[model samples]
Target chain A: MSTLTPTVPAKPARGLRSTEGKAPRAQRESPFARVSAMIVMGVFTLYFLVPIWWLLVAASKNRSQFNSTNPLWFADFSLFENMGNLIAYRDGVYLKWMLNSAVYAGGGALVGTIIAGMCGYALAKYNFPGRELIFNVVLGGVLVPATALALPLFLIFSQISLTNTFWSVFLPSLVSPFGVYLARIYASASVPDELIEAARLDGAGELRTFFTVSVRMMVPALVTVFLFQFVAIWNNFFLPLIMLRDETLFPVTLGLYAWNSQVNQIPVLRDYVLIGALLSIIPLIIIFLLLQRFWRNGLSAGSVK
Target chain B: MQIKKRAAAVALLTAATVVLTGCASGSTTSGGDAAACEPSEGKVDLTFTTWIPGMEDVAAVWNEENPDVQVKVQTGPNGNGGTYQNFFNQLKAGNAPDLGQIEYDALPNFRVQDGLMDLAACEGVLDAKADFVDWTWGQVNFGEEDAVYAVPQDAGPMAMFYRADLFAANNIAIPTTWEEFAVAAEAVRATGGYITNFSQSDINQFAGFVWQAGGSWFENDGENWTIDLASPESVKVADYWQDLIDRDLVSTNPPWTDEWNNAYNTGSNWTWNSAAWGANSIASGAPDTSGNWSVALSPQWAAGDNAAGNWGGSSTAVFKGSKHPYEAAQFALWLNTSDEALTMLNKSANLYPAAKSGLELPALKEGVEFYGGQAIYDVFAEASDHVSPDFIWGPTMTQVYNDTSDGFKGAVTGNGTLTDALTSAQQSTIDALEAQSIPVNK
Candidate 1:
């Protein structure tokens, strides 16, 4: 396996024209091609960003101003006040949900990533009887939707007295077959067998050689797997909704959903729900942006192999 | 060496999944013999799930009064179909709350699942039965055996909440009859406004109109159900609203949503034919319209016909899961009949009371500032009396409500006439009932 050169160029606008300029004269495209592409990209960016922009603005408005004022822009600058109320509501229940979410997503993704990475690395770098069979099974697990598993998983957890606890959600979320598949492909591409042999020759234990040499090469793949599992665990609603009853154990997404259901009865909670939605995404955005460098390399590496 | 580890991990993964998936337990609460309530140490911890706003305070009163049984109030989804779905899910999981807040319309759906306990067996529940309104009493005493499935909590007897300022500005006299309402609808449209937002999605709203027009949809003698959904009275109700839809005098937005909020916020729909709870819901959605709104008795079929309809209200029902039926029924009765509980419920929930006692509560008597300081509940109180008793819902009210709502969608979108929708909805109801082996008298 070899490194896959990233298909998305460093600058698409420049790359499209520069790559084309090298071709024959008759094949040359119109001058407006790049401009039109840029326009299309700009329109898509706006289309995607506008709702988030509106949410950010909506979070700042009070209950009265939410519907009465301009929808896409800020009015009363009540973001702080609303956030304060959201935190203070039901005696800081929102913060508890946020903590629960952090525990479920962060801890689950970390554990899932380690297992997935190790498993993927083994599948990609090693060959044994029934290897393809195992790979195919893991791929099948990836295709079986999480929602379909939620109730059955709940019943399983209930039998074991874990349904209402954090473990119910955390345990199911930790099995990321897709994560393992990514790790396997990434490991084959990045971590050379020769490096492992060299480490082995130095008399390093199998575990030691794998940790010191292979794990370092697998960092980008591991982070991508972790982020994938993290977002899935964070946004998970049905699993938590069906499994947990104690409000104290709820994730932010489920908590917001519960609040939103009562919005018509308590209109004031609408502001809190909007603000909570805005704030819940900020952490995910920050994490994604922070790890994007690793993600790009890992994605390209996976594709190339 | 790595090959061995790969094979080991795959085997382990497969083994783990097998164990996890294999652990799928038996279907929840399969044996009908859920053990009778054994109050340990004469103290039972009960979980009551409800969507009623301010239910916690009522629970607190129950807790304070009865130290022997601790009540934990869990919030369920709102009464608009979500609560029923949640109830069904919990019931399936065999972990439903001991007491579930069920709507009069949705009660039968839970009953059909054998999820509810017959309250007749619970001590003292029958004595407290006389405390609720006659119509509300009829709702609880469901099925052919005349069994009480639930105790009424709050009600939503319908009324026309009008914008007095808009009507006065237009020189439109208060509409006392359906013809006058149509005239006012046209007057409002003349001013580039709508009289009301006829939500194609709110089946409860349409049902309320039918109730006022003297249509039951279903009737039972504790044995066989007679479903007459397309009764002439109901057809008349549908035709009247259909005429309004054709005239474009009403906006066909879905209710209790952002789009409907926008219509009210902009004064597009100057009137609301809603339940007593509409005042609180309106206060939440369009607080700026306060002091401009007022309540009138819902417009009539005939000039002197004083019948009314109900849209949303719920009852506290004892699930078959209750370990202590006596205590559960006691809690349900107290939540409805206790003076402290009733006052707190009305104050916090803003639900029109199904209990006759709630009509006299000071909290309910207070003028709602949102309706321009009108004691608007008086109209709803009168409307509650007018709510035609003996109007029984079929076991498939949820499916029927949805089917009828879909009909409204057809009418609104020009795919079918309102009369066609009624005919289709009635046929669907009869077909669905017959499929379920319930008797359907078309």
Candidate 2:
């Protein structure tokens, strides 16, 4: 612990020097290579951002303006009015869906992170039988897609009489194999064996040592795990589509999809769908911007070690 | 000892699976029995699923009036989009809602699946049959003696919605016959516009044309089914549309898309030969083009003919597993036949009621400002009266529509003619019926 404390202060100077040394090398590269890289990045950035820009512009227009006006530019800034209509539509059902999404994604990610942390911690520290086999199985789980599991999950949920309930979606979302994999790798790399021995020598229990010391060091990795699971569960569509029947129980993704499908029958819903889609992504953007520092640290931690 | 305990737990799980399977199979068979239509002993709470906008308000009105029979409304996507698939899954899970909005063409599918309750035994169901239009009643009855599968909610009688301002400006006359319509199509093309946009995915609109040509696509005797999608009248209708597409007089933009809406809003399309409900579609889809449209009778096959066709209409049916069939039947009847409910539905969703008295509602009599202040419902009223009552829908209309839509898309891309599409769709429809164990004449 004393050795780690001194290195933490020295690490920043080393990082600064490394970047300072590379600055001249970057300038010495050929201008054509730099120009080509910039061009490629600029084209890809435009390709990705153009649709979002269109959505923002369309969300500000009314139904008539949407059809007659330019699609890529703003006609009138009715975004606040559209937001008011979206919130007040159908007795504020949009707010209810938003609350449901918060519960499903927020709650699912929190519990999932804890479970994956514990499972990964055990795999890294314990010398028990079948530890390698268990990790192998989780690796296999990471390879399987969520869509393939949805039908089987629905069948099991129906047999147990849990379909159409919150648990049907939340329960399946709680299992994040990628989170487990990340936690295991980080736990092995960052959690020191000497610290565990010292804590044990001080008469602390294994669980207490883990909760107090290991979890503190694993913060960056846990935050990374939480955000990944958060985005995955937030954008999930198929599971909730099949599990839930009531509109009030639907997450925002499913609710927006339902409204979009009805635009043909009810044309005014088209604007609502566009505005709802724009609002639904705000949380994801906010989350990424908020936890960006921790995510970056988590990604580079294993490489640094 | 660990092995013994694990074996015991596995045995218990196997037993539970067997019991659940038994219960699931048992419920499905009992769901089909019509003898379970007795009224419940206490207050009933029924769930009714539909896609109609503002249906919650209608149900709220009923809830205020009838405390003993309360309805919980659930809104979803339109029937063919996703709601029907949900209904099937819910039925299999034994938790389907008591009442659902089913289109007239889809009612046959529900009936053949044994998913609908025969409402004939419920109170006032048989006596209330006279309140609805004859064809709508026939749609629910399916020529059966003592069976009423659903209560007809709305009817979609077809007519022409034209841009009166555009026609007058182009010095072209409103077409009254098919031949005149084709000639006007040429004129509209010459003026850098299309007569109308041909919908490649919405096959129901094409079926309306065939219906106006006095063609029947399917006929079901008590024992078996007959498929005739390529009849002479149908082929004639198909060939007529083929010529228009070949000449590039009509655009083939997909329906309900932003491009399709923009074409109408910009006056690039001059007419839409759609059902009565299309008035709202145009009004909302092309809000800038309001007050310039007018409704007329659908173009006739011959001069001075008084025939119309039906397109999209729906019924409210009580599912077979509902425990409160009597309460569900009462609510369904009131929602469709009552004057206040019908008027509210028309105002909210622009639904054309299936009841005969609904046509006389003051709301239906007034001129719509979007349609140049014309009383367009008058045209639809006449069209409703002239629709042939003998047009029958088959038990697999969804499958038939899907097959025909795929073929139509191919035809639009110049892979085949419309008649060829129909001929191939006819064969696939027969094959689908056979796969479902339905006896079909090849």
Candidate 3:
């Protein structure tokens, strides 16, 4: 595990230099290849970023200007006004959706990560009968899509009279098999047996050793798991769509979708949907940027092993 | 580790079994028998789900006045987007809202599924029948004896919204008949503008066209459903539009899209034949053209004819399992029939109320600034009066709309004619009805 730590920092720098160094060689070998690569990357970058740019521009325009003015450019700087209207519309329901999204994503991810972490650590540290069977099941769970489970989950929740409650959506979100798989892989690769034995030799309980000693070593993995689960839960629409009928409990994704559908009836909601969509993705971008270093490290760590 | 693995495995296995069993046992509960519509004892709380804009404010008014029967309003997407699907799921789960906003075309679907309460037994429900327009009243009853399934909420009487300035500037006379409308389309195209943008996805609009032509797409004779999607009258209407599309006299932009809005806003499209609610659609979609628009009666198939089509309208229905049907019916009647509530709804959602008295509201009389100071609702009122009361909706309107819309999209792209779309859609509608176990005439 100690030997693994040094390679994490050194590998990124070497990787960065290797990419940078390839640029010169690429130019020297064939300008056409270099130019083509740059062109391809440029096209992909535009393909990915242009819709976001259009959303930003559209969110800044009033309803009149949305169709009358340039679609890809701003006019009259009505972003604040549009945002105020969106916030004030339906008595600040947009903000409620934003808050609900935070609770579902933030709360769901944190709790889901811990459960996944503990379960993964146990599988990695323990020599258990049926461990492979359990891991295989977890792997199978990862293969099952969330959309496929939404209807059955609705039925199960409905049987207990939990449909339309916050718990109906939150409870289903907690079981992230992908997070469990990631945690196990990272735990086995990074958390050494010697360190656990050493911690145990000091009379530490298994839980204490796992939390204090092993968890410190698993920061990158846990952060990756948290961010993954957060984004997944944040973007989840079908589960909440079926599980909850209460608009106040809706996540921003479902809320925006509802508004988008009503634009024909409430045409002004078009502007609100545009601005809401732009605002919805801001938190995702912020979270990604904040946890990017750990995410990158976690990805590299898994790949190297 | 062995204990933890066993624990995790047990948890996973249990969850999987529960889900599997849940799926296997997800048999739908048959709708309850007609309940005695009795007032609940003590204070009653009810849930009403609707997608209407400003419905919260309207419900708040109701809640303030009637504390004993407080309503919790949940707003979502329009019916057919996701809300209808949610309603069906909630109905299966036995947790549907006490009342839900169901469109007229969709009411039969819910009725066939046995999801609605027979409000005729409710206090004052049948008595309130005189409050709504005749057609709207008939819509709620589905021509059934002593069974009012819903209270009509709004009506969408069809009319033509045109650019007065564009028509004037080009020295083109506004068309009053279908033949003249065709000629006007040619003239408008000569001026480098489409007479109207034909919607490729809004099969409901196409249905409205057929409705105005004195054609009925569905008829239920109390035993079997009859689907006449390609009846001669319907084919005549379709061929007329098909000619406009073929000759490029109309732009085939998909409705509710930016391109469609741009066509209206930029005056590349000169007219739209839409429902009463479409006034707001034009005002919001083409703000730049606000002061230049005017409303006229929808063009006649024969000159001097007064037939008008109806498009979108909805009803407030008490679900089958609602405990407070008595209170639900009272609220629904008040919401639809009362002048105060109707005016509020008109201002909030541009709702053309199904109540006959709603046509005479002060708001309906005033000249709207957006439509060149025209008293547009006057036109809609006349259209509402002319809307045929016999246009029966089938039990699978969603399926019909979807199948027809897909075919219409193909027609617009030259894959087929509009009549061909109607023909295929006719077969599809029958198939859908038969698949749903609803008896259908071939």
Candidate 4:
């Protein structure tokens, strides 16, 4: 491990070119080609970034400025007032929604990641009967759209007297087949069979071997799975729209959507929706930044092995 | 080992089945979901879902007056898609609110689903009928021996609001007839202005014109519905708008959109062919244009025609699941007909009242500053009397509105004319109904 570690930093420079091409890292390329590449990337960056910039500027304006002012420029710094309105409008309902989103995403992702990891690890390492059939079924689940399941889920939840409850939303969010798929691929690649065999040889039971050895090796992969499930649950609008009736229980996305829909009826809500949207992004960005180390480790670990 | 594996799989399968059925059995299908109408201990608690804000304060006033019943308000804001769909889901679950504020057009949609209880059966609910204009009452209390399903809360009688300064500067009289309006539209366009904005996807706005032209898209005959949305009267209205659109007299941007908002706010559009609700929305949206605006009667199809149209409005309905039907009915009546309720709603909720007593309320009678001290309600009051009576809404009015709205998109996109909008929308409604084996008159 020590001998390979010193060479690892030097390895990727030579390694990437073999896969990318034998071309010497674009250094020998034309200046025109380089300039064009820079321009293309710069334009694409602006395309994605301008809307976000617009939103940041827009959240500050009141109703009249929202209508009359230039869309790209800041008319006034009424963001604090807009935030105040958003928070104070319905007795701090915006913060309640933010907390609901955190609970839904954090709780749902934590539960989803554990189940998906166990199932994926079992599928990858075990030789049980109908294992391929199970894997295939999970793969098929990845192809089915989440939206297609919501109505049926709603009907089923309704019959069970579960609709409008928090579980109706959280339970549906926990079924992330794609997360399981990623986990299976990740587990097979990251955790070697010989390590499990060694643990078994050390008088470890099946459950203990998997928990102590396999789980430790799978931490980075599981973080990736947690993030996948977290984002899916976080941005989920339609499921919550069908499931939750109480605004107090609504996730930030659904709450913002309801407010956004009311801009026509109550125009003052327009600024609130914009500010709320800008606020919704902050948590997702925070989660991403906080888990940056795990995300990077997960990506690189697969390649190095 | 093989036997153990198979047995474990079978056990798992059995457990899943048991859990599924156990969960399925929890549905309260046969009743007992909702409490009964009578007061339980001493005071009654009422729940209401509304789109209008500031209603809670009015309920607070009601609570202070009558200590026996305390009201809690729940609002869904947008009122139609999300709120109405949730209401339906709640109805199916047997947990619907006691009273729901439903739009006038959608009252039939609720009635067909048994979502509303007939207030006619609630006793003394209809006593307030004399306090409201006869037409607003007609919408809520029509069909099946004209049993009332809801009480009129507000009405949006259609009117024309224009930039008075813009018109006077351009040497235009308030265009009274459609022909004169088109001529003035060209003059306004000469100075890079629009006569008004046209919302192709807003079927409700277009329906107002069709109503003023004396067309009801749906006619009920016993068990069947006569779907005649493509009738000569509707087509005439469509043709008039299509011709103006082709001439570039009106901007074909959809309403309630950012593009339309910017254009309307900036005076790229000179007029608003709007319902009484527009007065509040415009004042809030573009406060700079407040004093420059003025109200006129909805333009006539022919010169001197007094026929007018109604647009959007909502009524307070008593749900079938309501525990306090009597209390709910009384509350609905009090909210609509009582002088205090009308004034409160007018001042706070900005509703154009449908009640006669509301006409005398100082808030309603006072000239709005946004309309340059114009008593806009005076115009709406006269327009309310001209609303064509006995307009039968269908069991699927929402479905019709959405389908027709989609059809109208083609007109704006220039894929087809408004004529196609009428025909396609009519055909779509027929196909939808016939597919369900509902009888349809061709």
Candidate 5:
């Protein structure tokens, strides 16, 4: 991690031919190659970064400037006003929605990630009966889209009298098929059998060995799983739209949607909707940025080993 | 083994307790409280759902007036989808609120389905049936006998709102006829900018123009359905607008979006085709553009012989599952057509009342400061009388609008010619209406 590549071609004064033979021919390279690469990467960066930049600049503008001012440039600093309006609109209901999202995402992802990790570890290390069949079934769940299952889940929840409750959303979020699949793939590759065996030999039980050793080794992968599940639950709209009838119980996505649909009729809500969209995406970006190191570590672990 | 058995037994007991408690609580409360309040009704709890603008104030007023009856205002999806879905779910669940907001076009749907209570059954309710304009009343009843599902609240009578300054600068007058209007539009385009902006992207607005031109999407002869997709009225109106787009006399943008708002606020468009409700949006959103704007009667088609038409209106209905039908009906009537209620709505958000008496209020007669002191209500009220009585909205009207709007996008956006666009839209609408089991002419 600390070493830098040797510069100046190892100072081989008499071996230019040998170095030339070893290195690929530079004559094959196109003139536009570097330029095109730079342009492509520049565009890719702009495509992502521009929206975030606009969000920051627009969030600083007051209601009037939100419509009239340049979307890309900074206007009068009114992030305070925007935040104030957001908090005070409908008597601070926006804050409640933010809190609800945090609870739903934070708690849901935590519990869901732990379950996925355990399930994945069990499938990867243990020689259980029907293991392949169960793994295949879990993979099959990924093929069926979330929207197709929402109505079925609604019906099931209604049957169990669980509709219109926190558990209706939280319970479904916990059973993420994609999370399970990713975790399983990661566990098989990242958590070595030697580590588990070492822990077991050190007088640890199966559950204790899995938790203390396997979990520590799988931290990077588990964090990746947690972040993905958290963002998914945070942005979930359709399920909450169907399940929750009470406006007070809505997550930010559904809440902002309800606000957006009315912006046409009530023009005052246009700025509010834009500002809300701007505010809601900030936490998502921050979460991704903070967790990226762990995610990258997890991705490159097997390559290093 | 003993310890394991004890834990298992404890878990089973806990699960049983949770299930029993969950089942026991909800049934016990609703029955005990809702039933207790049902007969005597001293402190009535009314759950009301609506999408009407300024409804919170109305709820506040009702709460103040009837301190004994606690009214809870629930809003559905801010637009049509939420309103329809919530209404559908509530009806299916048999737990709909006491009152629901019904649009004039959707009243027939509710009427056909037996989803509403008969408002005639409630006494001491304001007799708003006679107060509303006869056509508005007809709109509420769905042309059927003995089935009055709702009372009229407001009618959206549409007109051409033009900038007087732009017209004067262009040396043009408010065109009195459709042909003259086309010429004026051209001159305005040559002088100022885009001459006019109607939401070609909105099918309902297009249908209003088609209906005003005496083109019916469906015609019923008291027994059977008659579909008319290629009526002369339909073709003429469609062609006129398509020609306008081709000539670059109108905007290509959808209404009420950023493009539309830009055109409106910047005076890029000389005229806007809108209903009376548009006045409130204009007044509030673009306060600086006040004195430049004025209202005029819509240019009439030579065939229709009228300068006006209806676009949107709201009705108040008592849902079938309402616990307080009598109170709900009384409140519905009072809220719908009473002069006091309309006055409150108009004051808050310039909602033009459907009731004739409500429209006849001193407030309604006054000119709006926002429109260069033009008597906005007086113009709309005059237009209300000339509004085509035979503007029959079919059950598949929304579907037809969506199809036509999608089709016009190609023409307006310059992707295709008008004839081809209309043809595609006509075919799609025919398919859509047929799928909905609404009869269409071959």
Candidate 6:
């Protein structure tokens, strides 16, 4: 692919023995280069950070500040006040939503990651009959959007009497085809064949070999899968909105949306919504930052492989 | 390897046990017989669902008053009808909220769907139902006669809210008649101020205003969908608005949103068309500009127009299959139309009293501080009196309005003639109605 391109322009095709002889001088900087770069980066930074900054500022204010104060600026710091209000609102339901989200995300991601990692490792490392067909089917699953599958999932859950339960959300998160695909690519590159072959020669059972050797090698890939599934489950809204009727069962996203809708008529909820939005972003950010070291290590190992 | 398999088996069993325990706990409590809650037990868990913001105080007051029956309030998600949809799903699941808020436009939809309990079966609530304004009560009427299934929350009486300071600055008069209103708009335009703020892009509001001009969207047979869409009355209103848009006397504002709020707040437009609840949005959100604004009677279409059209209001209904029906009905009546509840509601959000007796409170008597001490409720209550009960609404109102928005935009933006726009709107409305199996005018 690299060799297909012509080295010289049509007019200069026959002029030189080596194109390296005609290297051009360093180009002069354009008049507006620095200014344009600064403008672009400025807008890009503001585009991402302005709303977040506003959220942080707005989250600190009480209901009155939300209504009366400048939206982008900090007023009297009422973060504690807002937090107190949130916890106290309707007998600490916000805390319950948070706990529910943590349970759903924590339990679902742990199980999902293990299943994806093992499946991906097997598909990549083992040369079994019908492997390609199974992989193809898993790849095909990636094409279907989650929302398109939600109604079918609901119907299935209804038949099984699992519609309004935690399992309805948990079970669906475990079947992540994209997670499997990622794990397969990572495992294929990371785990060498010699390791598996050596383990088998030592008379180690297949399950023992996977547990002691391949699974350990797949840690980074599994963690990545866990984080991906964790965020997906944490932010899950529409399915829960459709499936769950009990307020006690609601996740924070659905909970916050419920508050946001009433802000029009009940102006006081405007602050609650702003505060809720600010709090919502914290868990995801903390998770990302905490697990970033593992991600970096995964990248480096991939390069070595 | 044997040890590992055994450990996995133990872990799986633990997880299964946890799930089974959760299910067992739920089933033991609510079980197959959900309606087993006895009123005589003296402690009932009555769930009141609503989309309204300030109903908590109302529930609190009721709870405070009644030591025996406890009411638990659950609010639906804001703007999105999550609560209604959730309530509907619960109804199917046989665990519907004991009491819930219903929107006025959605009353007929609920009635037709068999989703609601017959509130006529509720013994004590029906006694107070007659005390509400007939038209307000008329909204909850499903069939020809008022076989009430829901109680009114508020009457959305519209009036012209104008920036008095801005009008004074431009020397524009608040017009009494439709002709004078057009002239006033022109004069305002000459002074470089927008005379009105309206979302001509919303055909529902357009249809609402047309209805205010004594036009019906459909005739009595319920099949003939006729509005004075292009009738002399409607065309007069449309052409008058079109002239405003063309001559730059109207601000190109969308209704009841941040854009419209900003437009009104920034003094980009001098006047807005709003209801009793509409004024609440303006006054509450813009407190600093209170003295600068005032309300006037919304300009009449001709000599005598029913100065009444609804924008939005909520109602309370008993969902079918609630466990504690009688207790739920009691709580619903108390939270919705009770004088004490309305009084509490007034303190929190200024919701207009749904109960007729509630309209006579000190809050109603005392002039509103937000409207420069103008007697706001008295004004709205008078307007609510003239609202025609004959303006019957159907289930397809929302769908028809959505389909006709493009035509409304075409007319407002001057890309099409008013007659063509309305003609297309009328046809689209019929099509939408027919799609729903709702009768349309021939």
Q: Is model 6 an incorrect, acceptable, medium or high docking prediction?
A: incorrect
TM-scores for all predictions: 0.88, 0.88, 0.91, 0.84, 0.82, 0.78
Between prediction 3 and prediction 5, the one with superior TM-score is 3
Computed on alpha carbons, the lDDT of every model, listed in order, comes to 0.79, 0.86, 0.87, 0.79, 0.71, 0.69
Task: Compose the digit string of candidate 5's lDDT tens values, residues B1-442.
Answer: 6346534543453344334323434344321111211232577788777655457777788889988776777664553656665565556555567888877777645543446665544564335566777778767655543336677788888787888888887679788788988898878787658878756666666766776776666654432345566577878888888888878888777776656666777788777767877776665455557788998888887734655767888888888767777677667777866677788787764678888888798898887788888887888888887676666665555666666676677677777765565667667766754553433565
Stretches off by above 4 angstroms in model 1 are: A1-36, A125-129, A198-206, B1-41, B53-61, B79-83, B143-146, B220-226, B257-259, B433-442
Q: Looking at model 2 chain A, which ten-residue stretch has the lowest summed lDDT?
A: A1-10
Give the per-residue lDDT digits (tens) of candidate 3, residues A179-276: 88889989999999999999999999998998899999999999999998999999999998888778899999999988888788778888889999
Better of 3 and 5 by lDDT: 3
lDDT of 3 by residue, B254-288 (tens): 88888999999999999999999989989999998
Q: Give candidate 2 regions above 4 Å deviation.
A: A1-40, A296-305, B1-32
Once fitted onto the true fold, the runs of candidate 3 whose alpha carbons sit more than 4 angstroms away are A1-35, A303-305, B1-35
Candidate closer to the true structure by DockQ (higher is better), 2 or 5: 2
- lDDT (10s digit) by residue, model 2, range A74-183: 99899999999999998999999989998999999999999999888889988999999999999999999998787668777888989878899999999999888889
Instruction: Report the C-alpha lDDT of model 1 over A175-248, residue by residue, as the tens digit.
Output: 99998889999888888899998988899987887778899999999999999899999999988877766677
Identify the runs in model 4 with alpha carbons over 4 angstroms from their true place.
Answer: A1-44, A122-136, A192-213, A296-305, B1-46, B55-72, B77-79, B302-305, B321-324, B339-344, B412-415
Of the true contacts between chains A and B, what fraction does model 5 have?
0.12
Please give me the DockQ of candidate 3 compared with the native complex.
0.53
lDDT by residue (A71-122, candidate 6, tens digit) is 7899999998898898887688788988888888888899888888888888
Chain A fold similarity by TM-score, each prediction: 0.90, 0.90, 0.90, 0.86, 0.85, 0.84
Residue B390, model 2: Cα distance from true site in angstroms: 3.1
Error of 3 at A4 (Å): 27
Task: Write the residue-wise lDDT of candidate 4 on B295-328 in tens digits.
Answer: 8888898888987888888899988777788788
Please, what's the RMSD in Å of model 3? 7.8
lDDT of 2: 0.86
lDDT of 6: 0.69
Scored by DockQ, the top model is: 3
Estimate the TM-score for candidate 4: 0.84
Interface RMSD per candidate: 2.8, 2.0, 1.4, 2.6, 2.9, 3.6
